[model samples]
Target: MPVWGWILIAVIVVIAVVAVIVARLVSSRQRTERLRGRFGPEYERTVGEVGNLDAAEDELAARERKREKLDIVSLPPEARAKYADSWRTVQIEFVDNPSSAVGAADRLVIQVMRERGYPIDDFDQRAADISVDHPKVVENYRRAHSIYLAQEQGDVGTEDQREAFVHYRALFEQLLETDENKDKPKETRA
Candidate 1:
């Protein structure tokens, strides 16, 4: 081959390689942004836990995939209202029995999840699945579960029990919200 032809071929190959590299970098950045936006703080926490960006993103992506297979649905207005009433009762009980109230709250949250088509066989798995749609409150769910565990040991104080109730409420409220009733007055959400 002529020298000029050889040089031209080499330049072409280099440009192709550079283009591939640029395309890959752009793709990686876009994936990161999409996952971060969807998961919110859960994205940061998972990355910190896994200590690798790719692995954490993969885990979060898996949650999305798993969630897609589930039959999660919003509660009907009547059911939503009933659960809200139950939650109010739990809160009222918190005044006299904070520890028991925390336990009731935990059970209530799980019942809501179960009724909404989320699997409740395991807490960790349940949280992972919930994180897909409710990233902001999954951490709250974790915190509340931890508190519930501590409460079972009788090592938690009233304040901690109250905190757990609040966390459960966060997740509960999110689960209760749906497009059909989001704009309704709180009293009529049921």
Candidate 2:
């Protein structure tokens, strides 16, 4: 009730404020780390696109929530074999018509995505959804899509088209392999 009591109260309040601040900072840092690890390069891409960390984190979190609600399923063995055969046909066609081959590759990838239960209404949304489970190959999907866009504009060269096919193949292979691996025995998976 005197000078000493007032001073003690002020010190305690300051300590409590500092503790709260520190706790918030630590919590923020941990959230960032978790998002970074889960999203990988997609995290940086989102941050770059959104121009801020908080918004990017929010977007990534929203994608995670949306992904949780979706019923993404693996392809059946017959479907897998059919898609593989279609891909082989596309590759063979590439020798005669690179442009059409690239176009077919793009469509095939989207078809595979659709068959795997991904919504194919929007390219960006499709990429975001795929990033949730296929973070590593999502970039390849983006790059392939970009090339496809350039091809549509007649801005891509033969070499660029080839690169796009390669990128699409990367994503296609990942998608196919993931479906196959899901069906494999636990002991057979590495």
Candidate 3:
């Protein structure tokens, strides 16, 4: 009711506001760090595309949420073996028919994704969905896809085709790995 009482109330109100602001800042920072750690280069790419930190984080979070609702599963042992053999064949084909080989690699990667319960209808969406689980290799998928498209137009060189195949291999290798078996070391390729 007096001047001193009003001054104390105002100070308390200011302190509460400051505390809320600090809490929010801490929360935002933690979210940024977690997304950066999980997404790696994908995080930077998303931010660059979206042109805002909050929007990029929101998009990434949406991808994670969308992926969580799916029934994505790992390949069975036999299927894994078959895909490995198929990949070997594709790689060998690259030596003589690089363009066809890269296209086959693209198809093989999509098939692996489909077998793993990912939607294969849309390339961009597929890449985004795959990014949730395989963040590190999604960029490789993009680069490979771009090269494949260019190859169809007869604009890509042999060197570019080779690079695309290598990029596809990176993603194919990633697709072959599931959370259960990811910790073990990779086998050497012939």
* TM values, all candidates: 0.93, 0.88, 0.93
What do the candidate models score in CA lDDT, each in turn?
0.88, 0.85, 0.89
Better of 1 and 2 by TM-score: 1
User: Which candidate, 2 or 3, has the higher lDDT?
Assistant: 3
Report the lDDT tens digits of candidate 3 across residue range 15-111.
Answer: 9999999999999999999999989999999999999999999999999999999999988878988999999999999999999999999999999
Q: Comparing 1 and 3 by TM-score, which wins?
A: 3
Worst 10 residues of 1 by lDDT: 181-190
Worst 10 residues of 2 by lDDT: 181-190
Better of 1 and 2 by lDDT: 1
Query: Model 2 misses residue 80 by how many Å?
Result: 1.3
Candidate 2 per-residue C-alpha lDDT over 84-138 given as tens digits, one digit per residue, 9 for 90 to 100 = 9999999988888888999999999999889888899999999999888877678
